[model samples]
Target chain A: MKKQLMTGVLATLLSSTTMAATDITWWHAMSGQLGETVNTIARDFNASQDEYNIKPVFKGSYVETLTAGIAAYRADQAPNILQVADVGAATIINARGVAKPVEDILVESGYGFNNQDYIAGVRNFYADSNGKMIGMPFNSSTPVLYYNKDILAKVGVDAPKTYEEMEQVASKLKEQGYATFSQSLTPWIMFENFKSRHNLPVANKNNGFDAPATKIMINTPDMAMHFNKLKDWSDKGYYKYYGSDWDANQTPFEKEQVAMWLGSSGSFGGLRNRVDFELGTTYLPYWQSMNKDAGRTFIGGAALFAIDGKPKKEQQAVAAFFSFLTSPETQMFWHKSTGYVTVTKAAYALTKKSGYYQEQPDAEVGVKQLSLPGGEWTKGYRLGFYSQIQEIMHREFDNVFANRISVEKALNNIDKESQVILSRFARTVR
Target chain B: MEQRQQYTHSALPYFLLVPQIAIIAIFFFYPAAEAVYLSFMLEDPWGQSSLFVGLENYTILFNSTEYLKSVVFTLGFALVVSFLSLSIALLLAVKANNILHGKGAYKITLTWVYAVAPAVAGIMGGFMFNPHIGVFTEIFASLGWDFSLYTDPFDATFVLVLVSVWKQVSVNFIYFLAGLQSISYAVNEAAMLDCESDRRRFWTITFPLLAPTGFFLLVINLTYAFFETFGVIDTLTSGGPGGGTTSLVYKIYRDGFIGTDLGGSAAQSVVLLVLVLALTWVQFKFVEKRVHY
Candidate 1:
């Protein structure tokens, strides 16, 4: 009789404990090591509070997860939280009734969300013209130059600070029967970074941040001249075209086929594990003459968004989870483990105070590169139908790289196609 | 034609037909109807509100040069994949049917290729054609031709078509093999006694008997090339070296699912449905008459 009574009491206690905790689902696109970090944040947050639980789900790539989010939202089944890439910010912002701005959600709940606490470039990337935080920046990154130290020593050349010097070094490397540089042909490096590093305008309205719509101004003499140089380099067998895939581009560099690689800052951890030779890191190159006053590099990683139209309890739980994720301790742990830039200033200061950069110099390059003051264009490009516009850029670039079209034609094509997409998106928003 | 037993009650026929009708209604007709409905409206990513946009979506797609290019590309791709897969599989099936020793082994080995998913086949193709570290690239380099598929549109599209054909030949092989097995040995023996060339005998008797199967396989192969090669194109070229290999189905998937352009993608899907439907009808109307069975 005493055992039965004890069982009934324990069952009742379990049910009540479950009732008190509101579960908030976070659908993210982080995979492999980064995926582990996502789960760790959720697990820690759940363990810290009995009032809420965060459920982490892996939903393939950014495009797929964004598509999934859209489908679910249409069905009124969106998760409480979502992870959207930097490129998708414009679309997410225009999702009027779908995504609740992180600032709005926290403010509504009477929770503290300091917009100024995040790194300036990150804050700008996830903000609107009013600098209102729409998404909480997480796992943000930028492109950096990675070189094989052995090749650098053999060639007797220091790291390049400008595009002109990079060409000279590449020419020397090519003469010695070595491929000079390889990189994935992405807009981050091919289009946006070049514009940012050169201090050139990517669009008419400061990379589409100042207005609801903007026309591209990238069809200019600066871009054409730079790509003309690239075309010449390609003809000389110095600039090898790696496929437009990130993982595929890494193989040529890791196998010592290419001496220098321009890749994502987040790739630091993986490259360290795989390469047998000592590695060197530096900021991306600038156009010395045209870009006398260059700006900071643009970021490429994703951010956390609090989804809209959930129950009040669930929305509160999501706000609690965001605070947990952006905490200095959690951000620092995430930054150290994945080589992604820590989003918060508190996390940045904490890691620096611990002398983390002194030990791993390569890990600091991304943070240092983005530390420079950023204007509207330098914050990053954010435009609706960005994925479509990106594809258009890729297609034009591909044709140019294949020698089917001149750089002038490619840039012209990109400008024309992008305007159409932007105009369509403008209509949608209206 | 095979004989069927007559059923007395009309209810029994309708009863037997219920499950199939229900399945067709739920799975095929319902989604198709929804796709048509969606094609007429501007549906945002989050489906909170969808506006009626009339023919704007279709007009936009029609005006885009890339969409038209994809139409021509898909037609060329489907033709090549269909012809090559059918001819190659038929030749192999003929050889395998004749071989008395290790026939099952040969058949099973050829059959297993179909078991591989389209995406897996594409990934395998990617490894072989990857310019940076591919074994085939090295081999071609040594032979005085630098066969890099990454930068060249022709090379990339060729790989997409080749991998898709490699995946589809297995299904064609099974049907052709079954067709070859159905022919009686006695007929061939009787023809041999009359003293004609073996090649001529095959042309006159065996080939004609295989027409019904060939026609069936051709229709299936064309449809496979048109509709089922999306994953192969995705993993192989991603519709580049400059949209060189973007097929109709692939564009629909990219626009609708990846880019989240619901109205645009739905419009494209509706067009694709009509195109395939007309093509199938034409094939049945003109080509099926020649089949001996």
Candidate 2:
């Protein structure tokens, strides 16, 4: 018995010495080149630390990854960290005990963390009702206007700043036999960006930040007018409708068939390489009469969240890894790699000093637009099932452009349909 | 009187059936039974909490215009895809059987598409029907047809049906070819002697002989349309332009997985299960009896 006991003790010591670092699994949805960058970041973090090791797993698309993380949590096989989309923030936050607040994690781990270090729009997005940080902002993107400068110069007009100016430019381009604009028929651009920038509430309860939003306010006159304008533009052949395919507009934009393309900020790095001509980016157009000063647009990418129920040591490891990620050097590397916004001010400053924005001026447009002062309505949506609601918005709004439904009718349908989802989500929350 | 052979050792027979029964129970019965149970309750996204809503999910689904519309679209989509694929496959098989030269080449060329996965097929179809760069779009445009699959529901549905039928035709072709070859040469000669027209002989004699294969393929195609074409619809249209092409299964996935409305999605599954069960039963009961061996 004494011999066996001695052997066991020696084996424990040997194992402890060899397996010193705590293992942390991070499930993310990034794919392709972006996925490779994620691995590099994790590898660098692992190399820098001796106490904690982060293993990043590519878990399909954003929705699939979120589902896998939730299902894992239920099965008690949850990862230490999960990367969830910006829209999924509300759902994850509202799901009690599913996540440990990142702010708390950092403070408890004794990191000199400041919430103000993150960009305002991004910081507001991943924060709770009481303004506590819920998730560490990672890959954030916003909508921006990309215009073919050659085509615009041929039309003899700069990129539009207001809705009326956009119409005039569209007409001007139409006369030149070029389609004026094209965009993804997504609520991220059409609804969320438009409403938030105009300081209009997409839902009651300050776009669901103050409380659980029960009513959808998408049918406001400002929104209806915008849809009406899009329909008119579509009818006049000023705007090209590329159906529901996300990458359909890229061909037209690259071929100079369309003068302007409203695309995600993250697409800048790729668009720069794909196009041979000079590309210019500007802030998303707003209605001048509605708002003299436009509010900020919401972020559209994913953030890293520390999962609950992990041990304190694991949580500390997650915090330390997050700090490393937020550092200016790592953020700059990630930004240059994936074209995602540098989440921290220090990172943005470093990127600027490195002459990235000077070489690619369009990359700064997203950061500048996102750093604009945000109002209560512009602090991103906190409604549950927002991803599905965004789908509904896209579907309904696409019908208007298709001439199958009127703009008013589409808005009415969106309001009614999204209400059911909101109510169901509210009920499901404990 | 004829004596029927029976298993003398009942335990051995039962043991022999255990693997199949166990697989069916674990894979199909368990999940299906769980779906039925969950359909009657409202569950949260994380499944941390659930409420016994007692048929509220069903009521909500039945009352919702969107859900009902999805059901109708699913039925219509299945019928259209199955009918189109089977007819096209049968026509190709008959033409190939009649051709003496390059029969093997034709058979091999036509049956190879069965190797492509549904998702890959969807992606290929997506590129081919892309509004701007797609060859089909350019062709249709030159022909003065506005074939924008992204904006127009009709255009999207057309592309979806076209892709689905194209992907599904290979399996149906192989089955039909096998069925055609299995027909006795004597029977074909007899039909040729009796019939004056080739088309009439094909319709009257050859079609009846191929009825068993047709019936089996009908069930298979319907099941494929109902469940397997999800990747196609998702990749092609994503059930958009006013939910014009959302199949029941697609809607279930969107609701259950993306939307995270578990109870509602479960209810949709139950409805789909009932629908498929009813369809298969009716086919077996009413249609199979007329099919000759």
lDDT of 2 by residue, A1-430 (tens): 9999999999998678648888999999999999999999999998886788899999999999999998998899999999999778888988888889889888889997687888888877888777788888889899989999998888799999987899999888988899998886467788888888988887887778777788878888888888887888899998887766678866788888888899898898889889988989899889899998997898888889899889888898999998899999999999888888999999999999999988878788888899998887877778898878888887887777778889999899889988988988888887
Model 1 misplacement above 4 A: A1-8, B1-12
Give the worst 10-residue stretch by lDDT in candidate 2 chain A. A241-250
TM-score of each: 0.95, 0.95
DockQ per model, Cα: 0.58, 0.69
Minimum summed lDDT over a 10-residue window in model 1 chain B is located at B1-10
Native contacts conserved, per model: 0.58, 0.85
Predicted structure 2: lDDT: 0.88
**Docking category of candidate 2:** medium
lDDT per residue (tens digit) for residues A384-404 in model 1: 877888888778877887888
After superposing candidate 2, which stretches have Cα over 4 Å from the reference? A1-18, B1-9
